[model samples]
Target: MNAPEAVNETDAALLAHAQRLTAQAGRPAPKALTRLAGGRNNQVYRLEADDGPLVLKRYFTDARDSRDRLGAEWSFISHAWSRGIRAVPEPLACDRAEQAGLYSFIEGRKLTAAELTPGHVEAAIEFVLAVNARPRPALAPGSEACFSLAEHIATVERRVARLATLDSEVPHVAEARQLVSAQLQPTWAAVKAGILSGASAEGLALDAAISADQNCLSPSDFGFHNALIDDAGKLTFLDFEYAGRDDPAKLVSDFFCQPEVPVPLAVHEHFIERLTQGLGLDAASVARCRLLLDAYQIKWTCIILNDFLPLGAARRAFADTGAWAERCAAQLAKAEAKLELVGADDTP
Candidate 1:
């Protein structure tokens, strides 16, 4: 079931390191290596062993936005597993020195919209709620949430400003500039003031308004986009490099915000109704979720333009195909749609 593939010195070293660590964990050394797809921040491969199938992830540091990638992932998942959450890949071994980790491979396919049945949608909602039910896990020493509300509007506003620093003459940059300055900045000032006057840095005054817990730990990116489902219909989630304690509002808003895998409004309605009534969340929390969603919507608008950056273009090998502008323009279009969609949604 393994494919024959070639790897160079860097990957060879990573595989050798994983072998030693897996052996230390009482697992067999990897006998074959086949690079798998669907990763933006790591080199993911199928490591064939006597047990036969496992996943090996090597952090891509050159262009990644996260810090302490391996440490944060290891700590976050370990804490999640310890909390009785279910259906995630089991960690087999981790080597921080090499910035690599091994996990048990799940036999499943990533579910696209066509393959995502109603049952799958229901299960996905349940899984997110369960994650929220668990206590927040500690961030790795040097790690933090992408947009935890504790940092408030100032944090993401600074990131938006950074996107303009390059002043690159790229179409993606032009579109992003238009969106962030013409639209996001003008709207954000008012929203920020409204939110600040309403609550403290911690978050909305949910405690005073309702008995519900404010925000639960998030996988940073929440969606079925990073998940798989087996023949038996079980869901196995993946990707936690950005996982940590996060703002509750971002959690709710991001569930259906991804550009690649869009969620239906009916599904959103079901998810919102369940979380609100089931968790006993108050209106204050709803307002906060809406506020953060507005900010994250703009944040993602800028992120789509990241691939046009100098280092990012090189890391993704855009020069090899020479379609960097095409890709950036496409991402810009997606960002525009995302802005319109989030702006139109009046839920809360």
Candidate 2:
């Protein structure tokens, strides 16, 4: 990623937008606006003001994918704040017209896989439980939230189908095409079959949706990947763009399946039991999580290869100005590694 062009903290339009939002929030104009990295779908910056530090974020907008990222994140954080959840940022101000929002800056570093400890895992579990302690009407279902096994399978199938459309002569694209056709497609077929068959064996209906009470507030892309450890050793979760009501099973699956800052599989059982027991989830929900792990694993493989798609490439380009061929090749390798985790039999 090229910081000069990609972030461009000096960009007049962005600075103007930030100034407007900060002024509206009753703060001194930022003496310095520094762009922050780690955001893949939006622009984030740290603003230093006379009072303190604040964060300004510009949500990504595209005709092809419109999910109201700004609204979702603002509403989710507001809800958590209202419930006395301090593990999230304070929602300070928003400029919907600018597709931007301002929040309390978090001084922290992204948690890495190597630094993960059981205490950290417990903190994450507690955070989820606290967030879901009660429900509110303001929140909507999470982006692409699936209620049934059939819906989950359909979502993955659609992603795989999109990847199958790759038909280019470029070296990286050509290699991706072969991987999709030979590995991804066949792996998805097997995973789909296994999920359907396993659901039947477990007496879980593929089309039947779980009751509303079973739904939990999910940080859609939940994982250590989205968490930061502050200077004081408190963990603060970020990126609620896809946060809202979702199947707890899906949340659990994504927690373990997310590749970045991967949570250790050794804690999988403890994590599941603690979350289920705390949230009062039924045994069937636990079974669903276990049975659906492979499906999610396959889904993540398709997600990792998104660099080959038009919209995916566009998002990547916006976030990181890397060479296309290099990124595509790296993503293909990641997808292959993720695919290998599908049947490693570590499902919780």
Clashes of each: 1, 0
Give lDDT for model 1: 0.65
Best by lDDT: 2
* Candidate 1 lDDT over residue span 292-312, tens digit each: 655666666656656656656
lDDT measured at residue 192 in model 2 versus the true structure, 0 to 100: 86
Total clashes in model 2, counting residue pairs 3 or more apart in sequence or in different chains: 0
Can you tell me which runs of candidate 1 are displaced by over 4 Å?
1-11, 62-66, 114-118, 132-150, 167-213, 277-282, 314-323, 346-348
Q: What TM-score fits each model?
A: 0.79, 0.94
The stretch of ten residues in a row with the least summed lDDT in candidate 1 is 1-10
For model 1, state the Cα shift of residue 321 in Å: 10
lDDT of 2 at 35: 76
* Off by more than 4 A, model 2: 1-7, 167-171
What tens digits encode model 2's per-residue C-alpha lDDT throughout 56-128?
8888888999799999999989988989999998998999887899999876788889899899999999999
